[model samples]
Target chain A: MRDRLSFYILRESPIHRMNPLTKLTLVFSLILLAFLGPVEWLAILLFTTVILPLSFLAHVGREFLSATARLLLPVIGFLFVMQSIFLPGGGTALVQVWVLDITLENVNIAFVNATRILTMISSFLLLLLTTHPSALMSDLARRGVPGPISYTVTSTLQILPQMQVKAATIMDAQRARGLETQGNLMKRIRALLPLVAPLVFGSLVDVEERAIAIEARAFNSPRQKTSLVEIDDRPIDRRIRWGLILVVIFLLGSRLWLK
Target chain B: MAQVTINNLTYTYPLTEEPALREISIEIQAGEFLAVIGANGAGKTTLCYTLSGFIPHFFRGELQGKILIDGLDTANSKLYEIVEKVGLAFQNPFNQISGSKFTVYEEIAFGLENLGLPRDEIRSRVEWILALTGIEDLAERSPYALSGGQQQKVALASILVMKPGVLVLDEPTSQLDPIGTREVFQVIRSLAHSGQTIILAEHKMEWIAEFADRVLVLDKGEIVRLGTPQQVLSDINLLSSGIGLSRYTRVAHRVNQQKLWPKGQRYPISLQEATEAFGRLLSQEGGSKK
Candidate 1:
């Protein structure tokens, strides 16, 4: 696992400068348009034209493409192969692989399904690659998201990495004491008990201390919280958000008309 | 008027038969530096939690008596209100980080942001505290990536940025290395010099002697001694109680046992005082020989 959990790349680009909620709206709109729009090729078309170009605009094109290929390609590729061969309702047979019959209609259906999943995940990746998690949470909190919810999201982003590091240290300590972590399955399973016990209890103690720490800082203060890093909700951002909403509505309308 | 008053205070943690603290009464004046010294489980941490309004509010323990800050009882006031009056920093620096903010600067601003300060005000206060704590260079670094010392300084700055009426630190340097210990103590000394009312629970007797106006000793949740650092830290009997005296005092007590130390001379609690007393004794011996 990566040392840090954030996908955000620190670079100055138009996409990076946009408001987090605006980017969030854009991602959701793209996902909705892909799933609800009345065309089989629409998801793949949006992924290529919109998401790819936006990644470059955000200056995270290389990271975004590589991350998508590395993280999502296997799942999508597996789904396409499996569904194209096993799905049972096609009249024309494309090919025969041993006992399975690959059909033309099933291949088309699988392609649409895989590309839709790709579109949904890639849009979110674009948003995460551009926006800091805490910045997003802060904006959401300012716009009426409860304090605890936002705190949980942002704190988890940071704390998970620290906990991972702590877990590694505990594992190393246990191994040094001859706990046998790298042998037969039973040995590894037994090693998990020693490794997990300390990590869980230690994290529990950290949780209590962290709770007190945040409480001491007035985390639950009965006041409207303010943010230090001001997220710019520019007029242009508002217009873009509205424009995305309209596009989504138009896509839904078109789907209804086609039906 | 006392800035903090703990009148006949006693506390028992949840599900525990023994009380963590008993009959703990003390009045701390504004801007006075009070140091509490005790053995493990001697109620130092418990007293700190009570002072900072974490005992009954956060910990939800059975508490007796009262703790008042600036004429407001902590039991009656909300934790947020009490936090405004008294800021708390504890031992584990890693745990104190809010974990929400990425940078040390933003971490320090977390508390002020929660207080609902305006953007410009938060920026200015965070900047001022960063400079004060001497962590200005670490401003943009992630709080998680910082060393224990830097993280503790950030923790202190985070609380100090709120500008609370009183500061309560519970063994703030216990987990730090020698350099880290010095770095944290320097910040605490600066805060104390700036007339911040501070109640620090500490084990570093030598450093406490230099800054603390009074030292309170606890043994088994009872106040065993309360006096100036000289009076409390120099008491030889404190060693038997598991709260060891300062090295200077121990050395002097060892010398006094051999009749080498001058009669009627009080034991020293710091290196400078120890050297001065020994210097005087050497000169007297030189004069007698002449």
Candidate 2:
């Protein structure tokens, strides 16, 4: 059922071989750069060449772009309106739409903002897809992250599909009880109530239970946790991680001094 | 010999006024297969949980007395350490697994890895368990893709990979259909044959009659009877009282009523045994007529 998810994750490719920390660092750097860059198409263009290709390089393929666009499209509409309508100034007033003016200044701002949003979302998607959640959790813990925080982060990915299944189980069970989710809005909500309530309640209970499951698995042991997908401290991997940190510093320097 | 001693154990769910279990005490051997049976609200599930360290730990409740697993009190031991000795594959097979990205193979390895076995050892043990459960082919497939029966096997395999000596189940096949039920029993049969201590709480007594070594009848959170299958099924009134009689035994019971067989004698636990016993009686009657 989830075969493709398993297939794509935990593979021994060079990208998967790199440390998740390194990937996390790089993605954070990319998002920071995207945030700090000038609201000019040229900066977006320059960043896209460096940042966007990393998704493909990490083996997510063309579907990566579609996934990013899918996630960003709804976000873009809200941000676009904000930049267009709520901007402090306008180069030239083009038209009035409702309470806001459409101006060339707003148009330029919207484009830059949308591109930046897409950049952040895409970089995150690329990094997470290559690294399994357990490995990521282990890496975070080894880096001195607290167990509860790391557990909350990793186990959601672990527990989400379980909740998803629980929801479907509820749906099927409710259907058998003669509830129709495909009906009117009220009926759909009514039908959904049985599914949602139990799932939420069950998940709340599961959090407590999973807390023990984690502890029972030695998660609370004072000894350090070892990842099954152990990343050797390769020179190349170290260099890449240090390199990303340096890039973030360089960009921070550029943003401060070059302005 | 390792033994589980329950001394004056009583449990009450926090919101409820009535105690689910009342002053229950029983002892089970280290590698014993004890099948507990009772009607709904009979406290059968509660007994299983309390005995296996899930009652006070996982479920919030007022628990009285102590549950000692192999002389180690559950109250004193950590759940993870206890879990290493006792594994529960929950009845809802799907929710029991921790991660979905793991294939059938990785699902089995998940718990084993947590137990900190060496890598090669984990590999061989996973392979061994997949074959032991007879799901080696399904190793590479996602857990979501398998049928209810196959997923249950994968779930069992995952728990078994840790090689926990005792396995407890709460109506493992209740969710499955007839065929799935049969397949689940087949896996359980093999596990029992391999000498794993199996504690199954089931309402379906026919399969339990054929498979279980000992039957513990729980009625209102008390052990009413503990005996061999032949000894327990022999009494019609006792069987119906709360023991959850098997289908074949019920049939044998009906026949006994028609003929009024010898009183206080044993009842049949299986169809074949019933047929043989009835056949012997019929042959004796014919010989007397001749």
Candidate 3:
């Protein structure tokens, strides 16, 4: 609610100044290239040379690195563990522990898969870090995405923080009334019902009112809508979008040739 | 001619046995500030929704009668069509937020944007309304970051920017603190003075006594009393009906019970009137003693 619920960083940079649709295209293109490029190390190469450098250009390098290490590394680590150990039917076993076997070929495939996933998520994360949700929704709506679809996405972004705040308040109030949330796992699980019931029921009541509110504002009116905050889409932004598409196609073509 | 006419209006919510409004009839003319006062479960909020065309359209309940606002029947028209003529801002300020925009300026422009107005006109209208509601400095701030009063003002400005003929406010300050209530009331007072047609339901009696042109008292979903503020607020039966009276009116009522007030003089409903009435009585008694 402060600026947005997403990872958007407010900064003045070329990436921040680009159109939201262009940044969106760039995100999908990066993801496509990471998954379909010919080289086995293509995911790692894109992460280092493309995504990391672009985060700096977007003036969010520190946030990008810290968030990646904090939020994504654990999942990737778990994936690598499972894939290297339980992965069957390939290559020589480098290590054998108890009943599990870890193989060099399996480890290599796991590393590549993990890096590809990292590249995919980071590309979308970069887009989120640079673009506001409203700007993205507005651009999509203008491009003939139905108004309700865009509205649902943007409203969900806004309401999520509010619901969390409400949940916290409910938890605090219940705790003050001698409802224990810190104890055995069973006790904590039991505490969740008291906390969640009010949050959910209270929010349900608000839904009717919010619907009436939006209707009052002519949200369902059948007409071409306008936007207040003007999003800029210069000639360069369009050219960049086309360039990203071509790169995605090239990556796909190379992947086919290799196969 | 932003007149609101409700005739024989009896409405029940969906799946409810008892009607929320019972055979209600009221006509509000253009540029009139009508204040509706009642206790909890007294049908005041229901009346506000009915006037704003949400009863038959949005709620889709069984509405026995018809409501006409600005010559358009509420039952026959779509809510989007009725909304252009009537705007409603209800009790909870947070719920009234459209939840679709980020900044206060865009929030105000949301309605105009949906209505397909030109960009320049929408900008000017939003700017003027921001200043009008005294929230020009908050234009760039996130709507969710605002205080309750500030958010309510933003809600009000969001509606007023649409230029609806009739504005219906249901306890817009109910969720605010004293200072916040005053801030919102100040904006509403200005809107009242500017000849806007307003229907307000409130529990605060002092502001109603001071600013409202006409007052309607509802009890058990029926119109019990309807008159000017002085006539309705100063009624002796108002205290017994559970709808609170202003402090000035209560004091005057006490004085009348003591047989000190003049036999035929009307009881005062506001502080200024109460002071003048007592002052006149005191001077007259002093002159007779001399």
Candidate 4:
């Protein structure tokens, strides 16, 4: 596992410098369009024309494509296979493998669903790639998000990597002690107990000290909080956000009219 | 009046029968470097927490008596309010990190931002503390990527930028290596020379001998010995309470036991004093005639 919590690549690209909330707005707009638009090709079109080009503009195109391939493809692939095999509404069968029949209608439905998920997850990945987690969190807090909530989100992102490192260490130690991890399901399941017990309890112990540490920094201070890094939310950023909102509204209206 | 006055302060954690601290009273004057020494579980950390208002406030335990820091009653004030006057750094540098910041510079500014300082002021203070703590080179580095010593320095700098009236450190160098410990102690020594009121709990007697204006030895939640470094660190009875004496003091004890030293002589708690005493002994024995 990677030690860092974020996929943020530091660069001087304009997309990387865009307001974090504006990037977030772009993400939500793409997802909404993919899910609510009454067109099958819209998902792939958005992914190709907008999301792919945005990644290149952000200077994280390579990172974004690899992240999507590594993290999102398997889940979407599994969903496509399950939906094609189990979907019973289609009339014309396209293929038959033993008792499982694949039909043209179900394939179409599954293909659209898969594309929609790809667009949704790719949009999120794009945002994650371009914007740092702390920058996103600080922007959110500035926009009326609660301090503790932002703290929780950013801290969770950090804590997960540390926990994974801990788990890996325990697994390595247990393996050195000759605890079998690669074998039948029962042996592998047995290895999890030794690895998990220490990780869970150790983190639980750290939670108290971490809480006190943050409290010592005045985490619950009643004063108006100030930020050290001044994020630029230019007029264009606000206009873009407004534009994204309008697009979302249009998508919802079109869906309602078609219904 | 003293900057910190704890009067008969006793505390017991929630869901526990035994009190972690009992009848502890100490007065620390302004600009004093007071060091607390004790064996593990002897309430050194508990006392540090109480000093920083975490004992009764953050821990939610039963606290008795009063802890007055810079004239604010910690028992009545909220944790946030007390934190403005007292900043605490604990043993584990990793745990002390706020974990919400990407750069060490922002991490140091976490406290000031919470205090609502303007951005320019925050920037100036953060930069100043980064230099003060000797971490300017690490300003742009990720906090998670720092070494143990660097993280501890960042933790110390984070608390120091808030400019609290008193700084409480519960063995800040306990988890560091020798070089790391030296680096942290150098920064702390500089802070002490600048006359910052510090209440530190540590077992490194040599460092305490060099920097602390006063030494406190606790045993079973009570102050067993409290005095100047030379007085308390050289006390033979300190070992009986499970507190380790400085290396110089240990040698002094050994030389005194062998009757090689003059009678009624003061024990040495530092290398300089030991060297002086040994020099006097050598001259008295005519060994300096060469």
- Candidate-wise lDDT, in order: 0.91, 0.72, 0.90, 0.90
> Each candidate's TM vs. the true structure?
0.96, 0.86, 0.96, 0.96
Candidate 4 per-residue lDDT over residues B140-182, each given as its tens digit: 8988888999999999999999999999999999999999999
Runs of candidate 3 exceeding 4 Å displacement: A1-4, A257-259, B283-290
lDDT of 3 by residue, A1-259 (tens): 5554778888999999999999888888877778777786988999999999999999999999888887789999999999999877867889888988798999999999999999988888888988988889988888889888998998888888998888999999999999999999999999999998898899999999999899999999998988776889999999999988888888789778877
Q: How much is A30 displaced in model 1, in angstroms?
A: 1.2
| Candidate number achieving the greatest lDDT relative to the actual structure | 1
List the pairs of residues colliding in candidate 4.
none
Model 4 global lDDT (CA atoms, 0 to 1)? 0.90
Please give the fraction of native interface contacts (Cα pairs under 8 Å between A and B) kept by each candidate.
0.80, 0.18, 0.84, 0.84
Comparing only chain A of model 3 with the true chain A, what is the TM-score? 0.94
List candidate 1 stretches off by more than 4 Å. Answer: A1-3, B284-290
Model 3: per-residue lDDT, tens digit, B1-290?
Answer: 43989889999999999999999998899999999999889999999899888888888778998899988998999889999999999888998888878889889999998998989999999999989999999998988999999999999999999999999999999999999999999999999999999999999999998899899998889999999998898887887778888888888889888888888888888889988998998998899899
Clashing pairs in 1: none
User: By summed lDDT, which 10 consecutive residues of candidate 4 chain A come out lowest?
Assistant: A1-10
Chain A alone, TM-score per model: 0.94, 0.82, 0.94, 0.93
lDDT of 1 by residue, A1-259 (tens): 3236889888999999999999999989888888888787899999999999999988899999999998888998899898998887756887888988888888888889988999999999999999988889999999999998998988888888888888899999987888789989998888899988999999999999999999989898988899987789999999999999998988889889888
